[model samples]
Target: MKTIAGILFIVLGILTAYQSKQAQPAAIDYAKERVQILQLIDTESKAFWDKDYEKWASCWAQEPYIRTMGWWKAGGVTVVKGWEERGPRTKQHMEQHPKPNPQNVRRENINIRILQDAAWVTFDQYGKDNGEPVMDMPGLSRETRFLEKHKGKWKIVYVGWLLEGEGN
Candidate 1:
């Protein structure tokens, strides 16, 4: 009876180890999702500075219900309800503002947290604007963005910017 009990214990131990090994793939999948989200953020930044409106738009969800909100150092909160609302405004804004030359944009101190199909991201962005650090301008800004997965792709769902010390 004692020998039989000992064999049962060993079998249980092996089963436990196998279960733990099965758990690892979830972690690996989460890490891969995090990396993909980070890459999407990088792509968004690149598209913005590159003046590629199409690419910039691609970073956002194409759904009719998908909305975007942005707060700037100078401008207060601006909300775009849907693509119809965002499209013309974005186009006009891009047309008005000149694309950064030499693409001196920087993304720093990025943190991403994944929660199931959603992710929250925060980052510091700084770069040279006319030979001066953009951070030195009116406001040093830290940005937070919310992303959601749709059709196996992560898209920016919301954007919030917090500004400190004003400049221009």
Candidate 2:
């Protein structure tokens, strides 16, 4: 009876560990992969600053959405929806600023809660613009994005950003 009970306990333990593996990958590997995803995002934001639409759009997966407090609201669509109007609006914003600092770079600190074939990401960005750190309603802008894995590659499906403490 003792032998039987001991064997059962070992089997159950092994099975439990194996079962948990299906939903979560190793933490170290997941963190590294998420860091890579953020680097891709950094490249994308730089393209936006340059107004390089092709490169900017390439940063996202095939179909992506950008929704922010001032950028869009209520079912906004596409990477470049109404871009004709957006260009001038962007120019106006740029006019308010001097040349950005060469060392300035946009950064996103992403904390991934789950990153298997599918992932949930929470992120916040920090940086200086034109030699001054951005100070909006929130100390730093925050965003949450969702990515899906297909054919072993992760693709971002959704992106939402806003200032914390500021209602929108």
Candidate 3:
């Protein structure tokens, strides 16, 4: 009876181990995903600064729940929710500001957390306008971006920005 009980315990332990392994999520390819995410970020920024409304819009998810929030030292806080409100406003802005205001921004201290099809990213950005450093939002500004992958493409779902010395 003791031997039979011991064998049963071993079998149960083995089965439990197998079940646990099966229940675990698969490993993510962080390196590949990071590269893809960085590329998407770059595309979005370039399109925006270039005032290419269509291109910039393509980087977003186009979902009703998407949002953009900002806290600026001079302007205080602003929030734009839903694609219906954001899309037309952004398009109008792009039309009004036809000239390109290319930004020379350097992103640092980027931290990205990826979970399957969703990703959360945060970073510090330092910018220079033309040859002079941007003093209005001096130092590093805080930025956060949330993205979701759909149909094999990653699209921005939310963007948050807080200028230096603001939102503290």
Best by lDDT: 3
Query: In order, what lDDT does every prediction score?
Result: 0.71, 0.53, 0.84
Worst 10 residues of 1 by lDDT: 129-138
Q: Which candidate, 2 or 3, has the higher TM-score? A: 3
Q: Whole-model lDDT, candidate 2?
A: 0.53
TM-score of 3: 0.77
Candidate 2 lDDT by residue in tens digits, 49-156: 554556555554553242323232332322433334444444554455434333344345657764556676777655443433332222355767666665666655
Give per-residue CA lDDT, model 3, range 1-106, as digits (tens).
9999999999999999999999998888999999999889989988887888999999999999999998865678879999999889888877776777787678
Over the stretch 24-95, how does candidate 1's per-residue lDDT look in tens digits? 644437778878988898788777666678988999876666666656555566677877776667666667
Model 3 clashes, total count: 0
TM-score of each: 0.66, 0.48, 0.77
Per-prediction backbone clash count? 3, 0, 0
Model 2 TM-score, all chains together: 0.48
RMSD of each: 6.9, 9.6, 6.2
| Residues forming the 10-long window of minimal summed lDDT in candidate 3 | 129-138
**lDDT score, candidate 3, position 29:** 95
Q: List the residue pairs that clash in candidate 3.
A: none
The positional error of residue 54 in candidate 1, measured at the CA in angstroms, is 1.0
| lDDT ranking of the models | 3, 1, 2
138, model 3: CA deviation in Å? 6.2
